[model samples]
Target: MKIAGFDIGGANTDLAIIDFDQGGDIENIKTDFRYLPMWMKNEELGGYLLDLIGEEIDQLDAVGVSMTAELVDAYETKKDGVLDIVKKVEDTFDIPVAYVGLSGMMNASQAISDPLQVAAANWIATSQIASIMSQNCILVDVGSTTTDIIPIKNGLECARGRSDFERLGTGELAYTGTLRTNVAAIVDKVPFDEGWFRVSSELFAISADVHHVLGNITTEEYSCDTPDSAGKEKEDSLRRISRVLCGDLDLLSTSDIESIGDYIYAQQSLKISEAISEVAEREFLDEVITTGLGRNILAARAVEMAGLDFTGMDEFLTPEECVVAPAVGTAIMMEDYLSDE
Candidate 1:
């Protein structure tokens, strides 16, 4: 059976097309993501999904979905966001559509009945994948806009918070991310010119700029939109990062730019590490299984700072595959849902 799984996040929508053999083994998989800010383009979702899955729609057996876009301010309430997204998905696809919820995969009716359960449960799908490798570990998923610190014990998720709001209180969610997070939110001060420089709390740049200037991500890997809507060039990122210190490339030396970017990168890693420590101390787990676009750089550094045994999902999945792991897990869960049905 062939299934298409979607992880519809607020900033990007990821898709995984998995072809499964008769015995339930995955035969092939193709994954991709599109930058679609839900706050601005929420209504264009249905068409985008169809376009993303173009040419293969006729051969698809079913569709599966996991989303975090409900938390976007585009909707007045999470319920309203869920219902609207669900309607778009329902209207777009002709085959069976399953929503990955906090409990398990559910049909549209079940999803409609309880929207909050499906609000931010994409991490649950990733945990399902993590549990396959380690029954006891924290799954640290650092995506474009947020990080999820999930604990799994005995092959089941033991997350304390069911909602994003509650997860923040439980230290299972960190608002910092790789490409889209505001630089001001990560650190207010940076090192430059042998002196500590306080940064402007404006959205002058994003984490992508820091990573790009530091060579953590290439121009192509800076997948999301830039803070200043500038070109995704090394020099452009250098300029953006310079602005965080209330300067420009003309004023800041190359070494100064590197120092500021490196400092911000370290502080961002600390932010995620602090959350990992909190979840680890609470769940009593010493090992971490990592995935997402930031898995290698941000997640890996944070795991090291947390002082835990770390394992990258790259052991079982390629680095590219790790980018949309929740989507891959959503496909697996949907296959399981089909068998159960």
Candidate 2:
């Protein structure tokens, strides 16, 4: 059988393809992944994505779709977005399209019967994937705009008491990231030549500037959106951070820029630490498994703040590959569901 899985996230959409016959090992799998900006804004995003797959759609025996879009809005808005995509896929391919449940980690067989209930339970793609990667631990995924903290025990997701709405207050669901966060959110004051000066809340620094200075993400990843990240130069990163100080790049030296970046990390770290503590207390799990682009840095600061040890996903998987670990894990879950039937 030819199978394909797609994970539509807030920042990017990832697609993975696999081939397998009945009672045979699935090999020769190929994956095609891409990063798109403002993906949720494209009304025809469903059709736009199908066009990318082209002929591959015809060869697929089954296709699966999963997303965290429900977290984006209210019930009707989310339902419309998901169903629209599902209808478009079915209309184009004439194949079965199963929407992964958003509330809990379950197979299509189980999810198909009651996706609403599943999604309502916070059935996210990460938990499904985390179940396969770790035994008993907290899964921390820091995405473009937010971070998710999920606790797993004995292959099942533990009810952490706090819902998505609650976590949002603790920095798990904010419009901040390692590459895109506004500088104003990190600090209220900036040091000038002599003493200190207040910063305008209107001005913000890109999370890229912060991560670059902190040595978390390299220039390669920072090259996309920052004002001067195109050249992949340290000077550009410095300039990006300095821009937050009202385009006064020369006002602050490179060392000062680095200091501001460190300050931002420290600020964000405090917020992350609070979120981690809430999750630990709610689930009674002390350990946190970190993943995603800023997982390493966020986890490090969170550990120090919470007095907990941090386990890096990189210890088991490469950073680039780890970003899509949930997609891979969801596909693995799909394979298991298909085999059981």
Q: Pick the candidate with the highest lDDT.
A: 1
lDDT score, residue 76, model 1? 99
Tens-digit lDDT string for candidate 2 (131-237): 65677777777765566777788877764334456546543443455666777776777766677666666634567777877678787766335544355466766
Prediction 1 TM-score vs. true: 0.98
lDDT of candidate 1 at residue 243, scale 0 to 100: 87
Residue 219 error, candidate 1, Å: 0.7
Q: List candidate 2 stretches off by more than 4 Å.
A: 18-32, 39-41, 47-59, 69-76, 103-123, 161-163, 169-175, 191-194, 227-233, 315-318
lDDT of 1 by residue, 1-341 (tens): 99999999998999999999988899999988888899999999998998889899998999999999998989999999999999999999989999999999999999999998899899989999999989999999999889999999999999999989999999999999988889999987776666778889989999998899888888898988888888999999888988888889889988888877888899999999999999999889999999999998899999999888899999988888899999999999999999889
